[model samples]
Target chain A: MTMFTRSDKVSETGGGAKPPARDDTPAPAEAKRPQATAQPLSHTAPPPPPKAAASTVSVISKALKITGQLESTEDIQIDGMVDGDVRGVSVTVGGDAKIKGTVYGEEVKLSGTVDGKIEAQRVVLTSTAHMSGDVVHQNIKIEAGAFINGHCRPDFGKPESKALPPPHKPAAAPPEQKRDAVVGAP
Target chain B: MSALSLSSLVKPPRRDDAEELPVSHLGRALTVRGVLDTEGEIRVHGKVLGRINADCLVLDTGGLVEGDIVARDVRVSGRLNGRIFALHVTLDSSADITGRVFHHTLTMAKGARVEGRMPWRPLNYFETLEQLPETRQ
Candidate 1:
């Protein structure tokens, strides 16, 4: 009888302790609950990747027509019509492209029609290129079938003494000096 | 650069035609200070200080636009200091806009900061828009 009673007391205590221990397990579950909530917050963090994946090169597609200045510190690929000046690090003009204004770049590859001048450090005119204006470059390569109407001068990065001075001094100084002479004589 | 002719700018491409056209991407290091006219889509991640005419336009995060935008669909997740004239407009949570948004349909997220009026218009109104009206303010 004593053995049966003692075993019942021990079993009762063990059963009583198990309920509190089960209650204590909820503390860690509550911690896990916050982690579950954090997963949704992490889902929100993925939106920046698309923005980060934006291309570094600027592309002007064939259907586009720009009528102002385009200046870029990176590469530019043009496949459309541009009525404005284009300045870039590396400029590539596609075969169907048409540019009316000057193109300034460190490296320029042309396979299109350009009506204005090209000023570049390195210039390459592909077989399909049709250039109407002068090309000023430090280094140049022209394919056999490329059509060019103007001279190609290897004068890029050279001092502006010959090219710049004539327009600035002669054009400006003559008008001013003549006006001053007339005024002083009067 | 030659001036952008109003006749060329007035003709907005149809939605079906724009879908077949390629998308133009203006990168973060680029700065355009003139008119951008496109029959297709344009995604701007840099700074544009002039008018833009496109079928669809997306101003990505960190992009800055300071002029008028005329498009069929315009989505903004960046900063815009000018007006937008579009049929469909969606302003993301990170958008910071300070000009009027004239659209036929508009969706604005919770955190979007808009300091101007959003006037709803009819579908035909956008289709018949020949030129952008002058800003009275």
Candidate 2:
């Protein structure tokens, strides 16, 4: 039979998953600027900056079954099972939904169970979510009681390539001392 | 590149009303019944019985449904042993559907298999294909 549950109630086990490592370290000069020029603590008034507010339009109820590839330009919610690939701007998997294929979206929130890989800009695994595949995203958050297995990699907008390090080179010694010994004929 | 940054700024304001997020897996101890009417999209990965009326209905691979479905667009990638009526029906390469399907457009990808017949009518189709001559008497 079919059952519907929210995305925040999937009872998954295990600890949280950490994000992947970065190769290059940002320059220290740029990092120190914020700390060097500290503003005085002001409790009186602070104007808000222009914020980028996100919009959400529709919701998915608990009674849909999709088997083939489903692609959309708008945000989507899944409360049922999907057997094929799914691509959307944003996706939310409810606690009662079961996803068996890959998911490609900008933002993905999981409170249920996903058996395949997930690729998104931002991914959040709630306390009730269960994931069993790799996650490739720029940002990732795992809440308590979530069960996740596999690798987590950062999304830098470039295809990840396996490159080896450059060959080592020994440092050369100074040339003045050798020239002085030859001129002295000692 | 700088002008592209302004595109987001000129975009419309955010809406407080948001869509519902999807639920990955179904509850272990719950039974679903009756009809599910949705305007957007719905995917079922668990067992579903009865009628489902929606815009788009997807049955993911490995999902099972033992009922009838009526929708504008219907797709199956898993296993379905029920009746289906839609404007367009597509079966992915891995789908295994046993029930009859009535649609204006039907597409079955390679590796997909169906064991039912498609009975055409002047105006409408039956809820279950079992009432047809090929399935029953």
Candidate 3:
């Protein structure tokens, strides 16, 4: 009989009892909630900035100096001095930059000084560019004020067949053609 | 600005222009196999297979360094496989380091994984660190 009476009372007060029970429980739950949320917030807050900074283009600023090779699948902007080879997809050599070794890239834009060779599909030498070595490219553009002291060859894709013919033919062909014309006239 | 001024005061008098030097960023797809020397700050997000000498070095997440680091302030959120000689070292939660850290002051987050000894030294130890001891290579 007592159990049956308690069951009836529980059913009658179920809706009314839950609110007070929740009110009593929330005092402790609210305290634990902030601590739980704060822990994760502190742990997760510091990593996003570094991750975002990492995904962008690399900048070798003017204050830095690298003494070896730098290989990148992405773009590289160099404003410093590099004593070794640089390989990138799109390479921008700033006006104050200096490279002592070879530069290999898909597209190379030079406004600085490259003491070594540049091997790329497309090469652009701006007004401030000072190139001292050979440049092998498929398409090349030399600005008016650019200084190039070496050969600029358009043989970029095929290296073997075209490499040996250009230098020898320009030097040897004119005299041979003149002698042949004179002998044929006589 | 105040922090910069404070750090400048605390640092040595040799590099007064350290705060004005621009930070160098090594992006994720880049791989450098040489010595990176800077007077300012360097943030490495790629792979560096050589030594780094900087005023401040931040090894960001996903970055991997496989050599020695000599810096004044070192903050690591990436993976390192070499020794560190710094005055102040802060290891974030995502840092996975596997070498010795010779630091004057060290702060490590909860989830950082370090697998070598961290020996604390006096402040003068870092000041006089002109040449690294050749006993341990």
Candidate 1 lDDT, tens digit per residue, A20-136?
A: 887787576545433533542121111121265788899999888888889999999999889899999999999989999999999999999999999999999999999999999
Candidate 1 regions with alpha-carbon error over 4 angstroms: A1-50, A161-186, B1-16, B131-137
Which residue ranges in model 2 land beyond 4 Å of their true spot? Answer: A1-58, A162-186, B1-137
- Model 2 lDDT per residue over B1-137, tens place: 01011112112212221134232222212123444544434556555555665545677665677787765557787788887766556677688989888765555566789898864432233233334553331
lDDT, candidate 3, A41-140, per-residue tens = 1221121225554556889988888989999999999998898999999999999899999999999999999999999999999999999999999999
Question: Which 10 successive residues of model 3 chain B have the least lDDT summed?
Answer: B1-10
Candidate achieving higher DockQ, 1 or 2: 1
DockQ of each: 0.30, 0.03, 0.32
Model 2, C-alpha of A32: deviation from truth (Å) = 74
Question: How does model 3 do on interface RMSD, in angstroms?
Answer: 6.0
Clashes of each: 0, 39, 0
TM-score of chain B of each: 0.84, 0.65, 0.86
DockQ-based class of model 1: acceptable
Backbone clashes counted, model 3: 0
Winner on DockQ between 1 and 3 is 3
TM-scores for all candidates: the values are 0.73, 0.40, 0.73
Q: What is candidate 3's lDDT per residue for B1-137, written digit by digit as tens?
A: 11122233135535447546878999999999998887668899999999888777899989999998887778899999998987767787799999999887676766899999999977666655654472135
